[model samples]
Target: MRELYVKSLPLQDVIANLAEAFETTYFISCHEYRINVPEGYGSGFIRGINFSSGFGLIEYSCTFKESIKIHFSVNKIHPLKFIYCSEGIIKHRFEEKDSLHLIDQFQNVVVASTAQNGHILLFPSGQKIHMNSLEIARKDFKTKIDCDLHYVDKNLRKLFRDLNARNLFYYHGNYSLAMSECIDEIKNNTLLGFTRRLFLEGKANEILSLQINDFEDDQKAEPKRQILRKVEMTQIQKAAQILKSELANPLTIKDLATRVGTNPTKLQEGFRFTFGATVNNYLNKLRLEYARDQLMIGDLNISEIATNIGINNKSYFSRLFKSTYHLNPKDFSKQISKNVLLEKL
Candidate 1:
């Protein structure tokens, strides 16, 4: 096992420390510092970016060759941290504590240690870890012009107001689909320079909002009323995979739900939340997408394409395809053929 210590404040210093520790090069553009892991240590990169608003984002996407522990210790009060694990597992514990909290995929934790207690993160060997940390310097954040946090939940409001770090705070819950989508956008964004900075700042706040909401929703006593849990999401994704694989002979909603270990009502709710469509509608959309691919290939006629995608009614399939892509299937296929011929000529 290897240990790395980072004693720094703000993102830039942290990244510099990490680059030194990893013996790798880091690039900086518009205040964002990014470093790729060196050959001997691991694969992937670590990034840290901060905004004038006192909010910072650090992304750790890596697979270490050996177990590694990164300790974050600052001389002053540590910044509030909201940590989310999107892949693999990460173990976290306050500097002064002994027990470990495992943040599994789709799980998030909000932590604020007392005074300058600091934090420790453990990354297991050979596991792909993708985690994000949203840090806030409470004193700096409070001084911002738009720092009003009255709308926040009562407990969180208190946590936000605690600039002196008088109390230790920690909350754990499964993040929402909304939060997951925001993470995806943050990870996959292609914007550059100043525009990228603006985008990241906005996304940081958006993710903070989602994290707060997800935590509050998890506090509800009624499990049924609470937002979806990570386990529930697993079931939902399993159902979606089944839907895609068994399109030609898809199971009924109840049967599918049973197969995926969830109830039908919950399954429907999951579909609406994750895919923004009813199961039937989502299935039809998949069929249409598959039909479009077949149409482009040109080997299958409209009727065969429709049948292959599980829609036996050629007329209904044609109408659905047209409604989705703005052209009839037959006409779309002809257009593809015409384009190909023109290219050949």
Candidate 2:
């Protein structure tokens, strides 16, 4: 096993420590530090950035030839960490503990160590792991935020308000679809320079908000059934793909649920939680969006375009289109044609 000790903070030092352990160089661009895996270590890169708001982000996307352990052992109070595993599995344990907590794909955890107790991350050999950590220097963060946190969820207020590092806290749960989307945006965004920093800070805060909201909702749920699970999210993703592909052949919620290997009630809840819309409502929205694209392309008549998107009735499609876009389908198509002609001239 290869052991790496990272006694650093504020993201930049963390990256520097890792780069030194691997004996490779790192680069900083737009306030983000990134290091590519050297020839001997495996493939992929690790990058991180820190914002002035006392929040930072670190991303690990790599595979190792041998099992690796990263030990974070700063002398001062450790920052609060919100960790998400998007691919493969990541095992984490407090520096003083022996047992480990597994964070699988689509799962997240909020962790705060009491005092200076650090964190240990384990990455198994040959596993391609993708994980993101959002760290907040609590003492610094509390000072920047408004003093009144009464609006914060009761359960989270203590977690967020504990600036003295007096308590240890940990909560593990599945990532909400909204949070997952935000993570994707943060990872894949291509904005540059000042805009990139602004975008990342905004997304980091958005993700933190969503994580807090999910934690609150999870706490409020009955113990018998946590509102969302990783498996259910997978099923919902499958169902969404089915809806998009099989639009012409609509199915009842029950049938769709069965096809996706989940129950109707859970399916409904999943759709509502993930997309903020009922199943039919989501389908209708998808259909309308597709119809608008076809209309703009001017490849099919209104009836054909409607049918293509699973609406068989031309008049009904026109009403739905008008309701959504404030323009009838035919008129919208005409406008597209007129714009194309004018552009050509």
| Whole-model lDDT per candidate | 0.87, 0.85
Superposed on all Cα atoms, model 1 deviates from the true structure by an RMSD in Å of 6.6
Tell me the lDDT of candidate 1.
0.87
TM accuracy, model 1:
0.74
The CA lDDT at 297 in model 1 is 77
The TM-scores, one per candidate, come to 0.74, 0.72
Error of 1 at 38 (Å): 1.0
Best TM-score among the predictions, by candidate number: 1
Q: Which candidate is the best by lDDT?
A: 1
Model 2 lowest lDDT segment of ten = 221-230
Cα error, candidate 2, residue 327 (Å)? 22
lDDT of 1 by residue, 261-308 (tens): 767767887999889999888888888888888888778788777767
Off by over 4 Å in 1: 144-148, 224-226, 229-231, 237-266, 273-276, 279-345
